[model samples]
Target: MRSYKAKSVTSIQLPPRERRETVLTEAGHNVFNLAADDVFIDLLTDSGTGAMSDDQWAAVVRGDEAYAGSRSFKRFRETVADVMGFDRVVPTHQGRGAENVLFGALLDDGDVVLNNTHFDTTRAHVTNQGAIAADCPAETDLTTDTVGTFAGNFSTDRGWDAVEEHGQDAVSAVVLTITNNSAAGQPVSMANIRETAAFATEIDATFVIDACRFAENAQFIKQRDPEYADTPLSEIAREQLRPADAITMSGKKDALANIGGFTAVRDAALFEQCKQRAILYEGFPTYGGLAGRDLEAMATGLREAVQPPYVAERIEQVATLGDLLRDRDIPIVTPTGGHAVYIDAAALFPDIPADQYPGQRLVCELYREGGVRTVELGSFAFPGTNRPELVRLALPRRTYWHEHLEHIAETAARVRDRRDEYSGLEIVWEPPMEELRHFSAELEPVA
Candidate 1:
């Protein structure tokens, strides 16, 4: 394997223990509220937190800043069409922006959008438009210990149950999230993608994909799916997306770019509708709320992301982290996932109840112990949804090396040693928006 070396470095410092305690208290025990300077290793999210490649930076200088019909936009559109097999592409500032535009145009009141599992922002966008966001994850998805090749597959049984209750016409679109983030970052098999597309077709609903980690998903398929073992990564990616009528992508993930995303569609009419909504909510069709330089970088990054070496290395790095934690008896999602290692918070702190926010408490302790920040995906994030309590340690693309992974594992082990000393948290204040309250909600240790 060829090692990719970093050409630039940035300095970061870990604040003292007393300072971390003070900052954690002042920030209402939320890692999101902490300043960047006070943190040592930031694992809050992989979204736009990666280190862009030198080639991507070079493309940035070559960007054409024209307001309309820019050269950068042409390259970006061409890349999407060639790689994703979608001719109609509309740029967006990020993945959620693409979701907002596509959902705004396609969905209506009382409509339903089904998925394998909807991430935080994706579900919020659907419900915000007065539509129902229904998730139909496979049974194995919830069982963190069960090892499966494609645990991210959508459950047709559950989906059919939803259809029977709501009627076929109520389902506006069936969206499949590749490498399902909400399900321990599990990968959706190519077979499942085709099955999902067929389900959408039978119900006369559009088939869409939330393809934030399309490349990572394809890499998994190549490694696990026997029929595609000899297929190239780029070809596997195209096949993975071929069943979709449209796709919403987050360039921050697989694309390896700092910013930029797009909505690509097979239908011309739907493309036009998405473009109009993009204009209303984002910006001009050419740039969509982002600079031309960002479009150029995204175009370059998209091509770079699917290369065999890059995709293999990215998945291997994540597996290494999971292995380190597992060796220490840390309860993580079995078989590991593509991008992040999900620690089973409930198992780690059996004494802490779900309603009391065990995931959030673990999140606070990880930071307080080693200045390593992560996010909780549990009752706090989902509120009344009753989702499993898991703490996600998302590793950014090419940002941290083996040493960093070791440090993260050590920090987790340290917390596990003193797990009994920790307690749960209670939400003291939160925003009015129920689905989006986790971002800014304030919490404290339960009395």
Candidate 2:
């Protein structure tokens, strides 16, 4: 494999000269509350945090800024059709915006939205519409001690049963989030996707995909599925989307673009509804919450993201970090996810009680001790005890070389050394009742 180096230049100071106390005070108790200037290594999210290639920069310069039917939109649509086989495309500012439009278009007051794992924004959008956001996560998700090949799979039987349990009339859509983010970034099998689609079809339900990480999921399919071992990444992706009636995407993750997303569907009526909602809420069809330059950049980045070398490199980078953690006998979700390395907080800190939120504590500690930023996917991300306490180190696409991963791994070793001394966290301030508390929840160390 060829080694890729970042061509961009920006100097950053290393570890803060001050002690941990000073840095902790600057960071507050919430990772989200911390400013980017204070953090040295950011692992907080893969969303809109990636580096763009030279080709993408050139495309951005060539964008045509037309009010309607812009050339940039045309290029973006063609790329989507080639990658996903969707007949119609509606652009959105980001993934959540796409979800809001589609869920509003399909979901009713009492409708049900089902997914393998509905990540934060998706859950907020679904529930905001007065619809039920239910998860039919695979049985493997509950087995937190072990890992599996497809832990992200939505059980076909469970999904059907959920529909039966909720009544078919109440079901709005059977959704699958490719590379289930909330479930430790696990990949869904092509077989499962096809089967789930078939089951949804049999029950007269719409099959939608939250395909934010479609490229990474496709790479996993190629490597894990013997039948697709020789298949190209684009074809693997095309087949993956074939099972879905529509797809909602955050171009930031897979496309290697900073900001862009779209909703694609084969249903003309549904697309029209999305269009109306989009224009009303977002902007015109041709430039929906994105500049012509963003559209052009997304078009270019999407094509590059699926290249054999790029896909291989992206997955390998994540595995490299996960492997380093495993080498130290650290607890992590084995088989390593495509986009991030998830540290099992429950295993890492058995002394720290779950109610105090060990996952959130680790997130804060990683930032305070090592100047690395990460997010908690456990009780902090989802307000429930059923989910495993996980701290996600999400790697940005085409950003951060192996040296950066080494820095993170070394930091993890440092944190592990003092794991026993690590205390818990308590929420000092939060809304009386908020949609997602993690975004704004204030915290303090429990002495």
Candidate 3:
């Protein structure tokens, strides 16, 4: 491994373009170089097309006819029915939009929702209801407590008891985030899912699945479990969905070739209620607040999402990055359960205190040092911003290559070697200045 000099005192500033070599030397490649000009591998965001054919775009343009009347809505309904096997489907603009509508419609004041864990936006919506969201597994559950935090661990008697005490009426819904994001992209076992669904049934609580990464989750289940290994990807998807009453999907993550989302209900009446609310918050039921192009792409994207080989290829690429990082001992999340690798910055930068949080420190250091930007998923990955720190590296839909991963491995090893003097700054909330909104504050390191 190569070692580099650390400056005892230096201003934390972007290196001048004229000092471009210094920037590359300090941080490697620009990690956040998705500037529409860089072909440098993109693994920071979840906004890539899965190489959809031009014909699909054409179909979206033709959507005016088949999706015009109630008959068109029926045709769109058939698409959801075919993909998820749910007869009642209500499309939404994107993943969070769908979540907002779903939570707004079902959650009332003083209600509570339980999740394996939650995404940042989801927690915001739950809190927006004047309701609180709680998780059964503690922070240590993902590390050194694998058995206690296994995906199916939701089947534990204690978990069931907690839900029971909350009472079905008090508990608005039980949400299962597929490919459990916070747990190092871990997947939920089928047995656990079925068991939890059964428990939800016993309590008459609605079962909701945040299926943003369903394709990736399904592929993991198929590869790890032998009995399910031979199952067709589509069949496996349907089986996983069978336990839920409603599903919210982000077409951007895996369904649509572009940005869009859908919220589908199993019960016709529930779907109608969701739509009535949609008209107010979103748009009309027919388009579900999405543009006609989005409606068209989502319908076709849902179909392509089920193709097994396509799903497998993406999963394989992610696993490859995991292998690379682990080989370098860069402290990345092992087993690479889902599609992203979470680098444990706390372990990488042990000198940084918890209050300052290494995850936040490393994010600032990486960008200022190398111009490569990644997300701070440790505390930010969760709600409330009070938890173990993490540096999250999301493998965008089809971005990056073997060489890119190699460069990442090299860069991470270098960062790990000189983390002693890096000082991270505190988070400060600010209004988002662009279309891509961030969680909490846009943090920077103290020079």
Q: Best candidate per TM-score, number?
A: 1
What is the per-residue lDDT of model 2 for residues 1-447, given as tens digits with 9 covering 90 to 100?
A: 545677896665556637545656655577787767777889999999988989999999999999899999999999888877886999999888899889889888988888898888888898889998888888884323557888899987788788889998888799999999888888999999998898789878899999989989999999988999999899998899998999999989888899989999889999999999999877997789899999998889888878989989889989999998877767898788899999998888899998888999888878767789899988877886368889999998877777888889888888888899988888778864355888878878788
Which pairs in model 1 have colliding backbones?
Answer: none
Better of 2 and 3 by lDDT: 2
Task: Enumerate clash totals for all models, in the order shown.
Answer: 0, 0, 3
In candidate 1, how many Å is residue 342 off? 0.1
Residue 366 alpha-carbon offset, candidate 1, angstroms: 0.4
Model 1 scores a TM of 0.99
- lDDT against the true structure, per candidate, is 0.91, 0.86, 0.66
lDDT per residue for candidate 1 within 125-208, as digits (tens), equals: 999999999999998845457668899999999999999989999999999999999999999999999999999999999999
Tens digits of per-residue lDDT for model 3 on 198-259?
Answer: 87787777889888777777777788778798889888888888889999888787774677
Worst 10 residues of 3 by lDDT: 1-10
